[model samples]
Target: MRVLLVGAGGREHALAWKIAQSPLCEHLWIVPGNPGTATLGTNVDLAADDAAGIVGLATREQIDLVVVGPEAPLVEGLGEVCEAVDLAMFGPSSEAAQLEGSKAFAKMIMLEAGVPTAAAHTFDDPAAAIAFVEADQQAWVVKADGLAAGKGVIVPDDGNVAATISAIHELAATNAGTRLVLEEKLTGPEVSLLALCDGERAIPLIAAQDHKRIGDNDTGGNTGGMGSYAPAPILPYAEAQALVDVIFTPVLRTMAARQIPYRGVLYAGLMLTPNGVKVIEFNARFGDPETQALLPLLKSDLLELLHKVATSNLADVTIEWHDGAAVCVVLSAAGYPAKPRTGDVITGLDRLPSDVLSFQAGTATNAQGQLVTAGGRVLGITAVAPTLREARDKAYAATELVEFAGKYQRSDIAARGLAE
Candidate 1:
């Protein structure tokens, strides 16, 4: 079957790798794909959100299936257009994508479904938000209602409360009318649990931990993702299953009960606290750096799984993962998440260890074809091995070999997971 995959990040690259492994797949095409995806199939010069163009390509190429890798296109109603054209799309419609597009909508769904989550209030006025924060619920999390490339959520330190509040106000001012969701910060270790949903059933994937902080020891501002590792050591077998029970099932059921009947990946970001696992947020597709880690561990044919899910035959499908550890270390251009520097020549990639796999996030070849620094989170160095220690070793070793002007990465990725 011919497939059209969307997005241009490490997540899309990982998805392409998995999909390409399927024996049933005859051809693959990635729209606005990155350098990594160029390995799988023909890369098309099409924007993920250009719905009409995508539909036109699907029609022109007679692509059998459309798999969307990012949330933006889904939020923009790509699935709706695909359905209109009778195209089998592996993404939710815009209405269904409200699960991730609008935090307020997701909270309402959880409230109606009795799903566990942190206490939060949706705000439109800047003064009102400041007053609420000053009133003090101890500690709080301020989030931009719309997608801010994962940097929307702010976790303020004791001395930086005023600055954090100012940042929140700045975001609100930039996107006025777009409300902000403020939550009384839930204390715990945050984890990412993703599932493949087919409206009626959802099959869980390996659990992962994403280190969002730019600095070591989980301090500093957030970027898209600093690093990630899968099958979180902190959550034991029983604990992991319990998390699914509390966070995934109810939420999926709620989406279905509302008649949305969600399809494609359902990502639940959870805060595993003393009480239990409380949902931090949800994504309608695979988490970026988490995908970098989880995809390598998947033993099942990704194409088969996605096809069955879109066709609503998930009862016959099972997601299998290798018994091991997979880790992804993100390499970013200097000054990421604020002012990123680009156009620097990259080096040392040829010297990377053979065992390590690199996932492209932000990159574009210069006129001379030298690998150049391009985006905030530039590339992902991923490695899988018999143990987390081994994987970490290989990843760091490969990272050492890869160098570019102003390249920066977190040295202590998966430290918490390893410590436990």
Candidate 2:
């Protein structure tokens, strides 16, 4: 077992390349990992929110499983400091990561677990959120009730209500003590759906589709993700099991009746609207370039489904996939998401193509070593096929054998599931 995997990006290098191809992950580690998870193992310079140097490096390296690939060290409590040293952590629990560290406490637990979302208002006074975005005449969505990584959500185009009230005073001048959820802009297509919880049964995975702007028909701004794809040929598997029965089983039965039982990787930033799957945020973990386009279409055994959701046994696991597509394609660096321009060097990551993999995410190396460009949605190529236009043509032909000095990507990644 011996896993560790906290974070460094490209969804922790695609969960350290599918947990080093599991056979029960004999050994693997990564904390401040990068350089594509230092080739799938020991990266450990420690600091995925350092909670006492990650429980003293998982009790001095005997770590049987930690796996918290981001969401600012599980919203800063680092899974209650690795379950207070009984350690075998995975993610949730800083009070179930406030369902992704507070979007007005996940719209007040999706309005007390009825679940379908959107139609909000939280504020914390930037002049009462610019007087409710100047008496909203629609097109709102201003977000930033905490975490601003996925560019803190904005959405202000059609008749730009004065740039959504000047982006709610520029995210209230850089989140001076956060608060401001304001929804009402929910229209169509957006689906991430992670799941895999053990807080008391939850499974759904495979339904990706991220493409968070940054140019190419969807237009600019919004980084963290620049491409993605998976079973989302427009959210099907019976509409992803009706978004796991109206959103992950009433938010895992209201976090197991509020004893705060949500364990890990919930995700679900859906929005299939026409009045159907309406949530647009909630990411307790796993969702970068949609976990590198759903872990190469995960055919199961991602370290035995995350050690059965960190030992809760995940109510009889049955997580399998790999039928058709997968596609990743992120690359970016040229001043991405405003001000990104790291070390540079990079180049054709060993000329990819054995079904293209990459991963990295803002790499590093230099000092005469090479492989540069450190952060700003840096690497990620992924491919996997069977269709979806041959995994978006082998992920844009391994994004043209990589490169650097201002790279950038998105030549229509999975072009609307290859034009349906």
Candidate 3:
């Protein structure tokens, strides 16, 4: 099949690499794709946000399948557009995407479906939101109702809800975010659980833990994701299954009953509290740094799994995961989650380990035709091994092969596993 993947991020790069390994994927292409995809297939000169441009390319290219990588396009109804043209697409329709597109909407759905989740309130006006936050004594979570590239949610430990309101205003000033969802922050370790919702069934993927903070100890502003590892040692297998059966299944069934068939990956970022697993947030697409880690541990043919979901027979298919552990460490440009300098010369990428794969997130070729860092969270060095320790070590070893001016990474990618 000829597949067209959208977006230019680390997640997309990992997907491209996986697709290349599948016998089902005869041809592949990417639109507004990154420098990494250029080596695999044709990279069309169109932005991921340009819905019309994507449709035009699909029509011209006669794309057999369209896999959306980022949430922005999915929230904008990329899948719906493809459906109109009879194009087999992977990702949720805009209506189904509301689970991730609007935080308030997701909370309401979970409430209606009796799914385990945090209590949340929605407010359109800034003043009202601030007032609620000021009076709330518990730790709080503030979120923009719409998408902000995984950086819209704020978990405040001191209950400073006003900062969330202020941040929304600041983002709105720059044409970013509005209507807010204020949630009572649940206490516990966070886990990113992703599964394929094939309109009627939930096909589980590997469980992962994403390190959102830019610094080593998880301190510092969130920037998509810095690093991640699969089969989180902390959240054991039995505990993860309970969350899926008690939480994810109920939510997917509710969507089916509502007549909005969810047909893509549903990433439920959960807080495993003493009480139970509570939803932190919902993501319409695959997690970036998490994807980098999970893909390497996927033993099954990805194309076959995706095809089953798109065709909607996921009830019978079993998605298999490798017994080994996988880890991914992100290399970032200086000053991430804020203003970042780009176009720095990168080196040593050619020496990447045979067992490890380096995925380019935001990268470009310089005038001299060398791949250069073009985004804050640039390259994802992913590797797999029998144990989490081996995976972490392999990822770090691969990280050493890559370099550029102002390049920095966490010395500890899977440090959380050490707590055990």
Clash counts for the predictions, in order: 0, 2, 0
Residues forming the 10-long window of minimal summed lDDT in candidate 3: 168-177
Worst 10 residues of 2 by lDDT: 172-181
What TM-score would candidate 2 get against the native? 0.33
Order the numbered candidates by TM-score, best leading. Answer: 1, 3, 2
**Candidate number with the higher lDDT (2 or 3):** 3
Provide the lowest-lDDT 10-residue window in model 1.
169-178
lDDT of each structure?
0.85, 0.82, 0.83
Best by lDDT: 1
* RMSD of candidates 1 onward, in order: 1.7, 19.6, 1.8
Question: lDDT value for candidate 3?
Answer: 0.83
Candidate maximizing TM-score: 1
lDDT of 3 by residue, 218-325 (tens): 887777888999889777766766667777788888888898889989998988799977877888899989999989888899877777778787876777777989
Q: Which regions of candidate 1 deviate over 4 angstroms?
A: 136-138, 158-164
Residue by residue across 265-346, what tens digits does model 1's lDDT show?
8998988789887888889999989999998999988898898878888986656778889989999998886898988888
Query: Which pairs of residues collide in candidate 2?
Result: 215-219, 362-375
Candidate 2 lDDT over 82-135, as tens digits, reads 777788887787878877777888889988998878888887887887776677
